[model samples]
Target: MTRARTLPAASHLEARLGLEMGQYSCAGRKAINEDAIGIRAPDGPLLTTKGVAAVIADGVSSAEAGREASQSCVTGFLSDYFSTPETWTVRHSVQQILTALNRWLYRSGQGLPDARRGFITTMSALVLKSQQAHLFHIGDSRIYLLRDGRLEQLTRDHTVPVGDGHRYLARALGLDIHLEADYRNLALERGDLFLLTTDGVHDVLGAAQLAELLVNAGDDLAATCRTLCDTALRAGSDDNLSCQLLRVSSLPTPEIDDVVGRLTQLRFPPPLAAGNVLDGFRIERELHASPRSQVYLVRDVQSGERFCMKTPSDNFSDDPAYIERFVLESWIGSRINSPYVARVVDPGRPRTCLYYLSEYVDGMTLAQWMREHPRPAVEEALYLVCQIARGLRALHRRETLHQDLKPDNILIDASGQVKIIDFGSCSVASIAEIATPLVRDSALGTASYAAPEYTVGRKPDPRADLFSLAVITYELLTGTAPFEGKLERCRSQRDFLATRYTPSYRINPRVPHWMDGALRKALRFHPERRHGDVSEFAHELQHPNPAYLEYHQRPLMDRKPLLAWQLIAAALAVAELVTLALLVG
Candidate 1:
């Protein structure tokens, strides 16, 4: 028979916070307090003056490592990442911290005994920033936002099924023998009661029990939390119990401002002709077309320098949001300096129709080049991914994410060099809110190359861009993507791969082993297992093993069109000879 561990005093937890922030955790009849709760106040300046906070972890006793791992997760994040000094956008900061926690717990659990091996816990953390509730969770820990005497469960649980293994979560942290997490965010309202609890509460008590306590708890949140623990104990919960009661003491209410006006009926006539001087440059001719922007080839009259001018699409001339985004991109784009990035020489004035110029790249986009040359040599493909990675590293260093990284967004110069373009989806590190919503309902990017996370509703990050680049690189190397081809249409992202796998040697018997391995890792469904940054990907590409070149360079079969035609002719001649002999007989 197993002797149970002793539970800690409820007072240790109860005494930490009084009325200002009420919280409680109980080990029940268990010997250890595997279940944990974390409650914190905004320690520094608020982006919207609304406090940022969270409650986390309901340790699964069956998973013995749950208690410490979960506790470490909450405390670890609070100590290392909270109140970031740099002006990082809320979304970026949240995801980055969660990612760190995931890796730490995952690495810790590796190689332990089966009883303690990969010990895991459910997590539900809420950050009340900018009057909005940013929620991050995994496994079964619960988050409830209560208002008007009602409670709302704000998180989805990851578990395995009981009867048919159906209730089982398809995804969870530290469960599938791998470490990763998923999160959701929402807007918050004052007078909201946020509940974070263990499965003991959610599993044993019905909605009526939860509703009754919350409604009666009233303003005495600490008393309400205690009652919840008592109710779970009375219900004879077989597992540990814990609950955190949070009231949105204050919800940020932003002051109203002027809305951007509609576009005017007047269309922007064609820009000045070539040699027509304006500002410090002379206009030449239009370089390309875009839905909301136009580019022109121009030369600096003073320095005789040539550059490409970017102006907003004639349709959005009046949309201030569009104008603002355009101008913001110009400022961000000018600082990019990598061989793979289209050079942005200057961020010109935004007053007259919102325009900026970049160095005129004399090369075709990767998209156009791909159309002309369906398959690229192995070396060329490797070189391209390296360059793209280098460019991405520059952007990452600047604390920016490309948000959109695809073949069409990359240009190939006269020299087999690659250049990344299109900063319209670029975002600064300080802004937590993502502005793009078009892709949520419909497809957001070029379907063939969009990352699975991007295809779904997840916010774009550097890893997302890496996924796209990996797909594009795969397509370039094998003359096809790992999924969604004309011959076999991949129905979903999961279809292309189940577990991580290197591209099959069968595709191009010539593909280098190391190159294939790198691509496969980049395309891993979980972000935590993949390379941390673009710089890592670049380093691997540059140092590809010699075996990779040797395998790919060997002649598998004569692919030359002339050889195919010769083979065809030889077959026809043999057929004629056989037919002639039959006639004579």
Candidate 2:
């Protein structure tokens, strides 16, 4: 339940990341040892996505091809984990890879004389991602954490004891057709040390002695591993000796200077007009130009393909945070794939300036579409909303938030297909993990459509986007912003709570009562009261939810303010007339 915590951007977080690693494996007294180890620490973007992977496998000595099994698992996991889609979460990606490796190990070893012991090995894997350590274990392999000078074992050995102090592996890779691996994630801290060992080393060296060795070994991880292994061998570890060591030196941070140092190397491109060419991209015409950026419709001279090239304005050429965000917009776009969302195009050639290319959407902005068709049917509007929800889902699943969701950011193609575009104000979870020096707003969308949580300085989530979508839907139905646009103007939780909610049905009689209930729920000022996710909101919109039947049971004042007030006025008039009659009598 205690997940990893994200540290805010600061100078301390800017410390360089270096994970010291040391591993050693030997057969000891045995002529053939079936122990294998692998470690991969990538330096590029893969480092941010896949993190660092460390694995150890101990093959069953009784199995004929135990050595092959251990080697295959170690190699397969390391290669496949990094190759997975970067959009995947650490848990989902690692589980899928390990499961596939498990199936392959199970099927491939079926040709052996005894399939039971064939290709049997214990595997323990550790992934050091942003501010966390993810672990997967099976069989007797062990993982230990050394923090604050206290060494604690993090993995449970999957073994069952037999008679006369004998034990056998109850769970191991390729031991059964079904794989049941233990997985857990823990918060990471600087200077935290991790140890992995096979039964050969652990059985010989007690935890106390091993902790002492690790302590005396100190900063020299290689020396620590060697000393531990030698000590284990000396202690009569005759079967085999294998162990791995890793220490977290630092955590990656989002220092402002870091971004400036990198952005200064890439100078901004010069002013351009139609027919001007730069880096094999011919500028056909400028599509949109703002104080922030200039979007140009460009033609790739080599492929003759057309696309949109977005370049940051030179006005902020000296700005580092803006430059970093511009670069990240392109990075976020490249990771997402959905027909409902815009696609980032790779130019195939190196660019000479700071710019990005996106697929040319042959359509108008949702705002323009709304103007052309002022009043759409309920079904039509909901259809458009469902498409946008799907697009939002794509972003949400990737751990990204479209902090800015509004009509202007959406595109409606000539074919009537909808696509949510733009990553300018989006937030990527991986990038956010790095500490930033600049102030990061919880929401960056237009105030008119931004959620109340943003106004209150609360962090935005997918539900915040849902609030924006509900605002758009309400506008489509009532031809007006909800609460006269007071929602975004809200500056405090109490302000939002005090703002009177105006149901859409009051303005548009065509809206079904049930549908309006759905809108009201999604438009709740507090995120907790809103639908848990996009799918829930979409489902309630398409179908009548009996749960929302309470919506229609409100007091007459809320149901019809004018009618209720009119009745009160009528009663007051009648009471005054009755007093006048008594006075006349």
Query: Which ten contiguous residues of candidate 2 have the minimum total lDDT?
Result: 1-10
Worst 10-residue lDDT window for candidate 1 reads 8-17
Once model 2 is optimally superposed onto the true structure by TM-score, how far is the C-alpha of residue 48 displaced, in angstroms? Answer: 3.4
lDDT of 1 by residue, 255-292 (tens): 21222221222234355566666566778887777787
Q: Rate the local accuracy (lDDT) of all candidates.
A: 0.66, 0.83
Q: lDDT winner among the candidates?
A: 2
Residue 70 CA error for candidate 1 (Å)? 32
Best by TM-score: 2
Cα lDDT over the full model 1: 0.66
